[model samples]
Target chain A: MAEERQQGHKWTMIVDLDKCTGCQACVVACHAENNVPSPSEDEIIRGRANHWIRIERYWEGEYPNVKARFLPVFCQQCGNAPCEPVCPVYASYHSVEENLNVQVYNRCVGTRYCGNNCPYRVRIFNFWAPHFDPPLEQQLNPDVTVRGPGVMEKCTFCIQRIRRAREQANVEGRPLEDGEVQPACVQSCPTDALIFGDKWDENSRVAKMIPHERQFKLLEHLGTEPAVYYLKGGETHVGE
Target chain B: MRRLASLSLRQRLILGVAVVGAGALLVALLAIVIAQTSAADEQPLAFSHKTHAQNGIQCQFCHTGVAKGPVAGIPSVEKCMGCHTYIATDSPEIQKLQGYWERQEPIPWKRVNIQPSYVYFNHSSHVAAGVSCGSCHGAVAEMTVAKPVVEMNMGFCLDCHAEQENKDALWDCTVCHR
Candidate 1:
């Protein structure tokens, strides 16, 4: 089905690494949008944490020349998703129409096999039930469910937003226009680092960015065909 | 279980039967209590759908957000009083409505029917598709208290969705249960 849509829209995300300021606005926006739950400080220390999108910080250079680099890691929505087939219950799979990785939360039996199989390591296991500190519960977006414990959850490319957009578009009897359905990360990126659009549309920003000589997938050598693309950093050093 | 090893075979069989019988009885009683509590029969006012429908009132007139938002919003106290202030000043129901209006306090209506958290049923989408209030809701025009006429389970949803005309965009698990 993705191949059939070769001339049609293929949902893809392009992240311009050069544009990322490491502000982690995208990460915070994702948590706010997706009800991904906040584990307590002790749980975070125990290596139990929940962030659908996490900014991986790396320090480069030495002796005052050191600079922290940020790479926001989320579900790549791989074309050949390694996390799909290994799912004993088919909870995580690719959507033919969306051309994006889809997770059926209710179907997930929490086998954690998908977590083990994901090459991106973006998949996370909900070790315990999610708890909200009083008023924080009011801030939750009702469109997304507060996933219960014992279910493996991860970035769905903010599929709830996509679903709403698509449904609205259908009701209006029109094909999705360019820049219509933005995943939470893309929408909240203050630096314009994340651009989500149909890659098949030649005029779309993602299509234009995908061909840049510096563009690369996280684990291209693994042949996972990650839907997320990254633009190589500029020659200038960050935090200078 | 290990302590029961010392008991005779006959005695062990009897214990197993007794434990199973008690468990079944407990389960049955729990089901009844759950059913009774969740019937959606009681409301702050004796709001009768039959009377409203007979008086030519549309469901959307009260539940204003049914076609625009996720929730089919309950009518506000002010919305109720807007008509009742002049129309039914002598009626007991109107008096109750006026009491709330005078106090400016919202009624705490008990929740009636709702899908599990997993099922993300959007009211706008269904309403826009021209599905009637009486579709999943049954013959609501004939009912007084809005008790659930259908179980409204996955099977119930699937049965209607399985029809050819209403089949599109309905099958996927992500379609409903996000």
Candidate 2:
């Protein structure tokens, strides 16, 4: 049984960067939750750190009028995903069930085509076998697989946890409840900047939030139709 | 008849040598199997699972992190000393534990349960789903040492999930893979 499909459910997230403190909690939480390999010190220095969701810092205006804007960017799971078509193997594909982009590691062969084709530069390649120092290795989340070298990996919206939560509810003979299966980034966000849920359900938070006046998608002109939405910054501090 | 039998002396020697070699090989194989099986059961130190369980020490006491995190971590020496400092001061085992704690060195407990690197098994999810530690670990409360009772194979895991009657958990390749 496919488990009564939450009919017309399209998962989505709306990140309000104005509320985002740029604390990087979502980034760290994503790393721990997804089991993304930690790059070595040298890799960090080379700007090769594997961050599925990163807060991109941008400087605007001159000194007195200067302001910093941080945007958290990850796999948009675009309806017309640029990364999907370039993949030689069908490693990257959009799921019909949740309208989520799923990255299957086993199916992936080391093709850099997807990485080069991505506009946001979110996709990262594994150059060497990921190693965790001794006891630190024990800290890895058993729910997520530790990827090895020569494979490409990006965000999966913490699909493993979602599957677990849904299965547990089904086994108990109940419907999937709201706030039951939250992505690690959503759970760990101290400022509550990230909201995730089924976009198709009119009652869902994500569905309700998407229509806000400030909402906009990254590179909307390209018509990528990313599931993720962002709220533009307000004019409260525009001149100060 | 005597001439004919004496002419095949080389054949008799070859047959005799082949029989001896086969016998030796059989003995070696038997010894190797016995040694390997015995090693699996041997404990690094005497540990009574029965006593700990009976004393009301929850499985999470020693195997921490089963609730809020992925790993059900093995207890560090300091965690043991939190109670053992007064509980078993005279025992040689306690003395060893204390020595390690004094030096601030964690005890290198040999892991009895191991899965392949490709697979991801979260203790928190299982524990949250009401799966007892005993379900997979066996009757740890009755044993003196931990031995793997269930083979931690992909098929073994799939079989357990299948019994749950939840298709959501059963067939997803990404459930265990990244």
User: TM-score: which candidate is best?
Assistant: 1
**lDDT per residue, candidate 1, A2-120, as tens digits?**
44454224688888888888998888888889887777799879877778888888888997898777888899999898999999888897776667777888889999988899877
Error of 2 at A219 (Å): 1.9
Q: In candidate 2 chain B, what residue range of length 10 has the lowest lDDT sum?
A: B165-174
The regions of model 2 sitting more than 4 angstroms off are A1-9, A133-135, A236-240, B1-116, B119-172
Residues A1-240 of candidate 2: C-alpha lDDT, one tens digit per residue? 122445334678889877887899999898778777667789889989899998989988998999888899988878778888888898876666556777777778989788898887888899888887777687898667788789898988888777777656645557676678799999999988899987766678887776887878988888777888998775763322
Clashing pairs in 1: none
Candidate 2 residue A29 Cα shift, in angstroms, is 1.8
lDDT of 2 at A13: 83
iRMSD, all candidates:
2.6, 4.8
> On residues B1-178, what C-alpha lDDT tens digit does candidate 1 reach at each position?
6889999999999999999999999999999998867757768888888998999999999999888766889899988888888987899987988888899889877777868887888788778788888888888889888878788999998887778463644765667765
Where model 1 places Cα greater than 4 Å from the true spot, the runs are A1-3, A6-9, A236-240, B1-32, B35-38, B164-168
* lDDT per residue (tens digit) for residues B18-92 in model 2: 899999999999999887655646654566778888888888878877865557887777788899899988999
* C-alpha lDDT of residue B106 in model 1: 94
Expressed between 0 and 1, the share of native interface contacts present in candidate 2 is 0.26
